[model samples]
Target: MSDKKYLVTGANSKLGKLVISFLLNEYQIKPSQLIATSRNPATLQSLADQGIETRAADYANKDSMVQAFKGVENLLLISMDAVGKRDELHTNAVQAAEEAGVKFIAYTSMPNPDASPVFFAFEHEATEKAIAQSRIPAWKILRNNWYFENLIDFYANVLHTKAWLTASGEGRHAQISRTDLALAAAAALVNSESGKETITLNGPESLTTSEMATLINQVLDISINVVHLSEEALEEQLESFQVPADAIIFATTMDRHLKENKSDGTSEAFEVLTGKKPQLFADWLQENKQSLKAISNA
Candidate 1:
């Protein structure tokens, strides 16, 4: 294997932070060989304190990304939260990696980005294509299923509102904890196999919002009625929570995705990659109940 270093972009993000930890702890990767990049490098104090090199890499500034990627061989391109700007930002980052002579990329993407009807998926599709066209020799497109973490705030909100509201009518999707996804991504980062691969990472079970709500109730020891809404109604509910207009649209479209598609595969892919079984959703929920309760009270 080459002695070139591995790097993570969006280092301060929720997934990025966890992936770094897994790489350092579980993978036993030396801090000297890992770099973390964020637009606001000052916010990466935690990573820096661990002796990992932290650099400024702003997606809006391709030059900055190119500068930050120097000497980096592998990159964990955690998708940014820039709704409308992901394609442009990620394409530039791929180009920047090439410009800086970086070798491989492992991107966290939504399931079926090319065909999924989710509003935010087109950019992922574009970024995937950009990576394929790039000069970088190898890549891994880790198409991550919906994160169970997406519901933490919603569960918290429902704890207060007493209603689990959704527009997805009897839709089901395999969901996994964010920590498992990080472990998978970290494994991909450290894997030195030199070929293009696309892996769809899904949880062990497909679950509807209602089923999830039941699990939530069991976890929190409280009752929450599952209320189905029209997509329009769902948007209104999101607005009432002060969610941004764009995010409201995104949430509804995700419901459509869940209602329409299936078979993203099971946790075996996660186990194969990480050599560990993904934590069961119920188990995860039980463990995180205190945090959910705290959010509810917030």
Candidate 2:
């Protein structure tokens, strides 16, 4: 495995970049053994300058995916950022990897894909099914829960409205950071034994919207009320923020799922993989207080 080539698709993404960081800084893997791919290879010039090969692997362009994946022994398939087109894009990419003789894969997926009520989870579930049906020799499913950074959106909204509006009644989310999830992905790709494995990675604790509001008030030293709304009212609230229609629908749907405890799963997979406990949400907020303040100012 040391000599095998590792390729990360969507390498310019937040999660992808962090995965590369752990693979290099933490694992000390040489750049020559890594390939970073994106639709525009030029965006990865920084990684290219670091001696890692940068390739054009467009999800919409099958030929590029096929050529870029050639000779890749292991693949880290970051989910496509294009929400509506993801299932098709992921299917094409997976087929390309199989045709390129890539034997192993590690996929970043949503928690409880098959059952999750989140709109995007449908595509992830489809991709997982595709991988299962394929002939890939080994695979790992890294089912990452929500990210703490998502609260930044809430922070942004609160900065304007001074209130947190949500349809999520009593549900709490186990939100981990992208950095921790990326480390878990890197570990699975570089170190895990060849087999079928699915790791559900989540934050240490679940916190409801009200609890999140309290955290914000404590961190920012400003009182902000959590306004519970019906699903229809939440849509109107999101619309007031000028949120795009599709995003409003997505948010409301996920909020409904959250109300049902869809995002409430917590696991020690991060500790098991990295030999360290995941950071607490409160601690992450404290550490990023400066940034959070900046967001408030923005």
Candidate 3:
């Protein structure tokens, strides 16, 4: 592990960038020991400037990833965003990692992929299985909950109607910040602990839609009422809002998962990994108040 490097796939993604930053700034992972890979390696110029090797690795092209993964011992496989294409993309990545003889893997995954109600969660479960069956000596699956930043869409949508629609009923789910998730991921990639593990990184607490609306109300100084919808009604409403066909199923199923407490509860595994408690949603709301305010203004 000391002789090889830690590599992060999808170096250009939002979570990927933050994970790299945490590895560098917080964990002090030296540049010589760090590698960043992206489909467009040119976009990682800043990372290259920092002395971290930037390699071109396309998930669609297994050969590129297998080549880029050479000399890499630890891999942080950021979950890809191309919803419809992630299954094949992740399979390619896992195959490449194994071919490259990567020793350990820390994969970012959705919460409870094995039984998640999210429509596309099976992709993550498949990825986890691939990693487990691979030649890697150790693996960690970081099951990240929904990010606090998801409210960007929720807020934008609700401001137009002044009523937040949900099928989650009174279910409370913890929404973490990307930064906190990054810290936890960096720790998982670089920490001394090894062997197969699945850590659920979560926020400090769970809150219902009404509780979240109250916090948003306090910050944005606007009253946003929570409107409970049946699953069918939620689907119809999401369709009415022009949400894509695939996303409607994703959202509706996610709401069902939430209602069933699949994505709820706070986990301390994060504090164990990073020696710091995860951020509070209320605090995140305060820190990003300006952006949230601007959304309403926009």
Candidate 4:
């Protein structure tokens, strides 16, 4: 393991970039000991400039994945972006990692994968199953909850339109910042003792949709109407707003899960991993207020 290198897939993604940055800057992992991979090598020029090994790895290409995993000791499989193709892609990655004799794997997954009624949970469950079947020496699953950044889109629209509409009637979500999740992931990867663990990462608090709107209003100093609609009504509203049908369906399903109280906000796994309290929604908003204001103005 000491002679092998750390490999991070999807190193160019927002969350992936944060994880890699934390691994380098905070964890003090040498760039020479790290390999950052993405579908496009050009996008990872900064990492290459930092002396990190860069590689091209397409999730769809089994050979590319196998080559990328070569000589890798530990791997962080940032969940694939290709939604529908995730299961097969994840399987290929697992196979490649095993073939490369990877000692440990840390995968980013969704919260409550087994119990989540949301349509998106299928891929996570399948990936977890594949990892278990692989009999990998060690594994850590970071089951991240909804990101606070997800609210940027709806909150921006609400600030402009003066109205926030959702299909999640009385639904509550425990949304954490992606950066915090990334920190937790990096901490887990760096801690040699944290192996074969499955953790649910969420915010310090769970908030209802209406509560979220109130918080947004408080932070932005604006009044925005928060309206909850039936699933069908929300679908129609989203369609009218030009959202794609598949996205609308997925959103509605997630909203339904929230309404059913499927989310567990009791997880302190993030704090345990990172040795710090996760950032709150208000602080996250305050930090990004400038960008949010710009979007509102636009």
> Per-residue lDDT of 1-298 in model 3, one digit per residue for the tens?
2545899998898899999999889988898899999888999999999999999998899999999999888999998887777878898999999999988899999888999888888889888888888888889989999998888854476754568888999888888998899889889999835688888888899888788888888887888888899999999988998999877887789889888788787768888888998988889989988888877766
RMSD of 3: 1.6
Provide backbone clash counts, one per model. 0, 0, 0, 0
- Model 1 lDDT tens row, 1-298: 3456999998898999999999889988989899999888899998889899999998888999889999888999999986898999999999999999988999998888988889888999999999988889999999998788877743456777768777888877888889899999999999848589888898888888888888888888878898899888988888998998777877788777877764245777778888888888999988888888776666
RMSD of every candidate to native, in Å, equals 2.2, 1.7, 1.6, 1.8
* Residue range 45-145, candidate 2, lDDT tens digits: 99999999999998888788989999998899999877887888898888888888898999999878888777888899888888888888899988889
CA lDDT, candidate 3, residue 59: 85
Model 3, runs deviating above 4 Å: 1-3, 153-155
Stretches of candidate 1 exceeding 4 Å from the true structure? 232-244, 262-264
Candidate 2 structure, TM-score to reference = 0.95
**Model 2 stretches astray by more than 4 angstroms:** 153-155, 239-243
TM-score of each: 0.92, 0.95, 0.95, 0.94
For residues 40-138, write the lDDT of model 4, one tens digit per residue. 999999999999999998877878988888888889999986678798888888888888788899999987888887887889999988998896789
What is the number of residue pairs that collide in model 3? 0
Report the Cα lDDT for residue 270, model 2.
74
**Pairs that clash in candidate 3:** none
lDDT of every model, 2 decimals: 0.85, 0.86, 0.87, 0.84
Instruction: State in Å the error of residue 14, model 4.
Output: 0.6
